[model samples]
Target: MAKTRTDLINQVLDRLNILVYGQSPSLEDVQRADRIVDGAIAKLASLDIYYVQDPGQAGPSGGAIEDEAFLPLADYIASFHLLADARTQALAQIAEAELRTIAAPARTLRTLRVDPALTPRRYGYYRGGI
Candidate 1:
């Protein structure tokens, strides 16, 4: 089963050590974390780590990211936003690296060749083949 946005937020709170067993985070905190999660998702999309074109499409009510492995990236990003400490920053960086590793397989590279015959030249004075 895929993890929901709430689950991601809870994970972030856990990482920050704020939502303990006997305590609950406030609504404001949860909302703030939700926004942070949205930002994190946007960042991932921007980096081509996550394929979703629009980050808002994966909101709390909307469908969640099916790949559970990427959840940690979102959690770390949200946690870092909630608490900008050295440890959180390190964790976020590591998560980004891990995400890149996970996403590497899905990415592809292609090279295109240009034919000299088709090239447009305003004189072609700089062509010297050695």
Candidate 2:
């Protein structure tokens, strides 16, 4: 998983075959590639991840979390998937599902995940003795 913007950019570029290992990129190619990466990152930054980010920053304000790194991985992967399909101008069903998951993750491990504070009690069911 990518921990930084540079890492994320490199991974996407590699996936797109825009850059290959054992070869240096030309300045023009680098600039063009970086533009695409920046576009994807900007799209990703619009997600509702639990992080403090500056007005203009593309990532967390205080930097990304190391222990809970899956958040960033999901963001980068979703962004890359979007970029790869830019020509289509529409995301695949799988990409849409991934983006949805990133935006609102489900708590499916438990059979019932509800907020006790928000749950209303039935007054009729209450009793003074057991």
Candidate 3:
């Protein structure tokens, strides 16, 4: 199951302690948090660094669980070590840097492979040059 927007918002709120432990969030707060999550996702998407499934579709509460492609990326982003190391930094800042770090290399590689002008020289000759 793919993780939904609500799940992400709850995680963020929980981390911030806005929603206390064992206490459910009110409807208004949930709505507000949902918007925040949307904004964060939009910001990340604009950079093409965050990938997830069914981003806009509605699902059960806390949204749907995350899919395989998204899970690993999410885990890395939410990892305790990285969070602890950047304790003083805002979550958005850390997330942006981390997402960029994970995506920039792949973007570069893709550009290199797709752009003939940027591609590296190859030595071996093939039977059918065409």
Candidate 4:
């Protein structure tokens, strides 16, 4: 699992609450994290994924297809997947930068992973006792 904005936000919030409350999270807050993570995933899917011309633009007329509307959606699928992957990677990087909240990550490990707070990160940024 890669970190997204929600993960980063939750991690930071946890850190802040620890600083302010000098304590751990309640069971309700733990359950709310689960809901927040799921909602972020659902929200992310609504973004427009890619900008490339559609495959259908190849054209039956032999002339170049002109209108963007003529393109097939699948052509954009690869681009969106790529974008999503990149977004995941980026999110991990952001979380990694918040290492003040996690165990000190190794130099090599940092380069090899993003937001270990997620799975690949192993940073233990979660609240329910990683």
- State every prediction's TM-score relative to the real structure: 0.65, 0.43, 0.52, 0.26
lDDT of 2 at 54: 22
Best by lDDT: 1
- Once superposed on the true structure, which residue ranges of model 1 sit more than 4 Å away at CA? 52-59, 79-82, 106-130
lDDT of 4 by residue, 54-99 (tens): 1121111122222321122212221223233564445444433332
Which model is ahead, 2 or 3, in terms of lDDT? 3
* Residue-wise C-alpha lDDT for candidate 2, range 1-130, written one tens digit per residue: 2155444444445555567797665656545555554454455566543332322234312233232433344334434443555532233334445545555766868787799999998678556786
Residue 12 shift from truth in candidate 1, angstroms: 1.2
lDDT of 1 at 117: 92
Going through the candidates in the order shown, the clash numbers are 0, 0, 9, 2
Winner of 3 and 4 under lDDT? 3
By TM-score, is 1 or 2 better? 1
State the displacement of the C-alpha of residue 127, model 4, in Å, after optimal TM-score superposition. Answer: 74
Candidates ranked by TM-score, best first? 1, 3, 2, 4
8-123: candidate 1 lDDT, tens digit per residue = 66677777777878677778777777777766777787878755332333334544545645455664565447366887777777777777776667535667789989978766
Give the lDDT ranking, best first.
1, 3, 2, 4
State the displacement of the C-alpha of residue 72, model 2, in Å, after optimal TM-score superposition: 9.4
Question: Where does candidate 3 have its weakest 10-residue lDDT segment?
Answer: 75-84
TM-score of 3: 0.52
Cα lDDT listed for each candidate: 0.65, 0.46, 0.52, 0.33
